[model samples]
Target: MLNMFNTALTALNANSTAIDVTGHNLANLNTSGYKAGTVSFEELVTQDLSVDSSDINGNGIGAPVLSRQFTNGTVQVTGGLLDAAISGNGFFTVQGSDGNTYYTRAGNFKLDDSGNLVTATGENVQGWMATNGVASPGGVPTNISIPPGSANAPVPSTFFGMNMNLNALGTVDGTNGTFTAPVEVVDSLGTKHTLTATFTKTDTNAWKYDISIDGGDVDGGTAGTPSSLATGTLTFDTNGKLTAPAADAGSVEISLPAFANGAGEQTVNWQLYDSAGASQVTQYGEASAVNSNSGDGSTAAQLTQVVMGDGGKVMAKYSNGTQKLVAVVALASIQNPDSLVAVGNNNYSTTPASGPVSYGEAGTGTRGGITANALESSNVDMARELTNIIIYQRSYQANARVITAGDEISQEILSLKR
Candidate 1:
């Protein structure tokens, strides 16, 4: 009778614990990146009942053990630049304030005042910083920083291209027709200079062109006056296609003299051909007009915004209309994620049962791909939890009834003795 009472008590305790675990899951139904908690019950030691001691029956229910479900959560698009979600398996690695490494699935990150990316609890997000616009995934992970007022150095003009139409019906005499096209180029010191090209009809199928710069010196010429840089003749075939100065040899090399403002001399290659090795200048029977002009140079630019991209690449956009990779978010995968020790704040710490963490770049190996401007909703299913609540409630009541029945049987035996 006493053994029966003890068994019922143990069962009641286990059922109560199970109910509490279900309540916990219900509480975090809307929590971000929250994995549902499940309670598992195991049988306790059984006692031999027969005289031979070979046959045995269960003694009582054992304590319930709580573990995470580790199931994937629904991804919600939040449209926040730093918001991120894992589409498969992996956790975002962060360095906690306790100086211990922690992993989390919640990616609601923001830039701290010091420009380091951190979670709501202020843990530093780890990643690799890009150098020279290139990132190495195998590099060591460090705190990702996007300093305010960050600026990109100026890129001197190395190549310039223009598409234009040169009038084929212009008079052959140089005095009768001249066309001028101006292009903007940036020097090493980010100083803008206007390069003017003048074309004069010199023959029936040829035109002489002169490249010069204003308020500057060209090829070490005197400043404050137009200085000629290069002079060449462009010969077109009868079909109006450029035939002379073959595509490979159709580049103009010019040098700019040092400016008074301390800008260094800039050497630029003026490309006459486009990417397809075709002449940009056409000798068509139309009015002379510059259709488009482009150069590979820009003034110094300040950081405009930092955007998180798919595959965990953090890109910084500059005011000069350029984007560069700044960092790569790191991800960690464990053999048994459910065994990870939850240290609160939606973070998990490694345990012996969880196995070793496999660190890698997002979207690589068993890691999941990152989704920017989004977040993962909790995996908790409210309807399921509610049903579990009722089941556990019934279980608790049944165990309590068992204890009541055992007590009544003991009382009946006592009454007979009285």
Candidate 2:
């Protein structure tokens, strides 16, 4: 009778624990990156009732074993600038406030006050930050920090290119003899200066070229006068193709002397041909026209926003419509991810059972690729959990009936003695 009671009690306890596991799963159905808990019943030790008869009887139900399901959940688009999600097997490396390293599947990250990438609970995200728009992710990763309001310094003009045709049929004495092309160039101090190129027809299929700037832009000169900086001659063939400036010859050089604005000396290269040896300056019979001209220079620009791009890249966008790859988020892959120990806040700590971690950039080795502007939802199934709840409830009720029957039988036996 005592054994019967013990068996029923064990069944009740196991059923109660299974019900608790189901409840926990249902409660966290909406939690981001939450893994569902699963329960499995185990049988206690059994003994042979009679050795000769070979009859084996089961003892009782033992406690249910609880395990976590590590299957990936559905990825949903969130449209957050910094939000990210893993598409396969991998975890984001992070450093918790406790000074311990952790991993997570959640990618809903934000920049803290100090511009450090961190989770909602303030855990620092680990990655390789770029220096001067270059990043090396092969090295050891540290906390990724991108200061807000950062700016990109201005770059002075070094190369100026133009694709235009000087008239081959124009005369040398009329107003058609001179053609001027004005382009804006930047000095070392990021000051804009207008440099003009004048072409004068000297003879048939021959022309004199002069590169000049404003006299006031120099150290000492008149404000309104145009100062010549360089002079050269352009000789074309009968086919209107440039011949004096040979194809093998390099770009025309323009040197700027000391400026009144205290800017240093600068040298700008005037390209007559493109990289593919295509002629940019031609003496065609068409009308003289400056079709296109450009200079490589920019003013200082402010940081506009930081965006999370695909493959775990962090891009810093500037107000000048330029983007720089500022950092790369690192990912970790474990052989046995199911063995990881959950430390709350959607993070998991490494354990001996988890095996060694393979850390690298996403889409490398066994690590998964990342999706920008998205989040991973919980893996809990509502219908499955609800059904589990009913199953455990029925089992618990059956165990209670056994206990009630045992109690009634004991009472009858006591009454027999009375």
TM per candidate comes to 0.90, 0.84
What is the alpha-carbon lDDT of model 1 when measured against the actual structure?
A: 0.86
Please report, in order, the local distance difference test score of every candidate based on alpha carbons.
0.86, 0.88
- Deviation from truth (RMSD, Å), model 1: 2.7
Candidate 1 residue 124 Cα shift, in angstroms, is 0.3
Model 2, span 1-418: residue lDDT tens: 9988999999999999998889988888877788898988988867665574456566688888777898889999999999998988899999998889999888999999888999878899998988888888875679999988888877789989888899987999775788999988888776788999999999999999999998999988678899998899988888887776777885788898878988888899888878888778889888899999966987668889998999999999888777889999999888998788888898999888988887789999978899999988889999989998999999999999999999999999999987
Residue-level lDDT of model 1, residues 1-418, one tens digit each, is 7788888888889988988888888888888899888988898877665555766766798888888988889999999998999999999999988889899999999888888989878999998888978988774478888898888998889878889878988987644368999988888877677889999999887989998886543444556788777899988988788877778787888776776557788788878888788888889888888999987888889998888898888999999898889999999888988889889989999888888777789878888889999999999989889999899899889989998898899889999977
Best prediction by lDDT? 2
Runs of candidate 2 with Cα error greater than 4 angstroms are 48-54, 163-182, 199-209, 230-250, 273-295
Write down the TM-score for model 1. 0.90
